[model samples]
Target: MNLSEHYNALFKKSSELILSGNYTIDSKINDESDRRFGITLLVRPNEEIKANIQAFLKELKKTEPHQYYYPNSDIHITIMSLISCYQGFSLDKFSMSEYVDIIEKSLVDVNEIQIDFQGVTLSPSAIMLQGFPTDNSLNVLRDKLRENFKSSSLPQSIDSRYIITAAHSTIMRFQKKLENPEKLIEVIEKFRNHNFGKFTAEKIELVFNDWYQREKNTVNMCDLYLR
Candidate 1:
């Protein structure tokens, strides 16, 4: 299937799971005391897109009041997970300058990625902003990162969990049993075609972050600006 078809299937699957009561609940991913750190590169949607998302979220909050909603500060499009999270991970053990150099070099000639944020999609445990990149610039950037990182001396667990091929961003994750899945599904269906506008990403952040990418738990290591 094509990229659009693949994500459409994902949305349909999640919707079916919700209606049939077969979805997974949240895991201990939000555990405050558990320490797991990973490095991730991501892009943030501009203010116009954020405003559109906030408007939709205002409506969704009334439907699922107890679930975790991502704050405006944390909304981002992940470019790559340079390293997957693991317990007791620390930046002190690695060469931060090396990572910065490699990232800056990898970004060379990578054009700005234009994205259209529209609709909602979900996995069994979370709701996401369905992002569609207009071209293959996103893929090129990702491949360059992997290629450069692999050629370097640094150890990385990039895509060990899975390779990222889509452009969606998680907006909400279930932390408790869905009190009323039908009502939540109603909200999903209502704004499933939301147009959050389009913007070209001018920068990407490389961060050392917690599993959740919560702003309080994240530290920005460097930023790579695009053309």
Candidate 2:
């Protein structure tokens, strides 16, 4: 099959699985989440800084084959993962649209946002950029979404203290076993100082991923307007 046909088939199969209620898998206790979508104010860096940071990530991916690292998407700090679907429950089209509005109303005043990826580290499942300045801004929006919407209506698990509630991006996933833990962190420490300049926090997006399909992971990006 051609590339387009191949992806189309995969997307078809994935949607079928979801509609059939067979793909609603829960994250394991130890699985660290790297995927997030929301109103993120991405700090745009200068060309030199952006190039330098990207080069660092490229080297990390090469040296650390054991960690699951995906290619870098647009760099931005996350506000929240608009809970898309959960096990045992299906999100209807209208409900999804309404809740998007609800989520928007919840975070009307959050105009300014600050973020930085200080360095990298190896989690048991993947390598992540250690981020900073965990303020109430992200959490407040999360709590309000839960309060305004029923538990089953949101896209992801909304339990208090849930790791997704903490915003951090997984830069790489170790595909193979690491021979030495010390070596992994040692490499991480080298680029630990890499930083992307700050951007104003303005909008949120309903980000979804088609994890079942290769190359089509970014399923949809729905923009959430702020007042």
Candidate 3:
């Protein structure tokens, strides 16, 4: 299996789980979408960090080989993922333009944001590069988004807790049957001290990653920078 195959399989598995009535798609969707949240502005990796992730993946392969290999997408972090309902939630250019205006006018400014991926850690299921949050730019954008939707009469999933979520792009994911609990724990612990250097958050993009609809449009995640 290749990279696309791996992603397709994971999508299929998740869809199947939902279809089987085992999982309910409710406002509590975050618990299920650990990886897919919405369009988030991620700090692009410099050459050094890119090489490090490549080397890291290589080490991962040697530590625990699998039938399917993960394709290194080269994305360092996720800004946000489009909501699953975003496919059904149609927004015309006019409406989107108005929303953009609101976002632009109410946005906040941040000097810099940084997060260092140190070591590895195991979530409930998958292995992850653990790090602390230092980026307020993206968070400000997310907040602006909520305010934008509220004032524009656009229905949004309520997220009142204002949880400080960590931002990292998933390098790979495994199905339940394919999980190797012991090896995963071992690998995560070994790389717990892995040093991924800091990168700046210059701008955020409202990327239209509508995988289901097969459409994308990039808008500055900040309204202040809108052209």
Candidate 4:
């Protein structure tokens, strides 16, 4: 099928998945000490691109004001979760700093990556703007980091189900079962092939949790600039 047809089919399947309650909605734990550190490409969309996305969200809010929209500061494409400082697992600040150093050293030869945002899709948790990189730079970067983390003595955050094959930036999330799910689908259908613009990911960040909060935002512990 074509692009529009493909996304339409995905929308239908994802909507059904949401209704089926088969997936879990990601949430942050209450305690500050329980938050996890994640490696990610924090996207800073240009003014034109940001304005375009904000405009769409403005229109969507008219019909679904209860939906949780991601603020500009919170937008990012997660690469991999590094370590958690929760429960009996203790990752001290010094250790986290060491991991950040390792990440920086590992990605020294990587170049800036070009990414294009297009279309929109629904997931069990949120509405997302799909991201496509211009080349295999992102995949190569992820694999390099993965190998580095695997060989390190650090306590790696292991979630067997977590994988990042494709990138998507979250737009908004459902607060409750939508009163009219079709309306949201209609909006997505309109932008199924919309070009939301492009940006270069020049830096990768080691972001601390609180990145997921609406009221608050992510704190970048450190960043590694691409060559």
User: For residues 98-173, could you state the per-residue lDDT of candidate 4 as single tens digits?
Assistant: 7876677667666777778897887776788777878877777778777887888876763444665666777787
**Candidate number of the best TM-score:** 1
lDDT of 2 by residue, 113-224 (tens): 4444455443345444545543556556666766665544544444433435334455554454455545545566576555644333445555553331113434443665
Give the better candidate number (1 or 4) by lDDT. 1
Evaluate model 3: give its TM-score.
0.60
For all the candidates, what are their Cα RMSDs to the real structure? 1.4, 13.4, 10.0, 3.9
> lDDT scores for all predictions?
0.86, 0.46, 0.46, 0.66
Candidate 3 deviant stretches above 4 angstroms = 1-43, 67-76, 80-95, 135-138, 158-164, 210-227
Candidates, ranked, TM-score: 1, 4, 2, 3
Say which prediction, candidate 1 or candidate 2, comes out ahead on TM-score. 1
Candidate 3: residue 220 Cα off by (Å): 9.7
Measured by TM-score, how close is model 1 to the native structure?
0.95
- For residues 1-227, could you state the per-residue lDDT of candidate 1 as single tens digits? 26668778988999899889888877675676779898898999998888888887888789878888888899998899988989999988767888889888887868788989878888998999888999888888889889999998898988899989889988888888888899998898888887888989888888999888889989998877786
Clashes of 2: 16
- Ranking of candidates on lDDT, top first: 1, 4, 2, 3
Tens digit per residue, CA lDDT, model 3, 104-212: 5545454455666555543333444554455455567656666666666643443533332555545544442333444544554566567866655554444433222
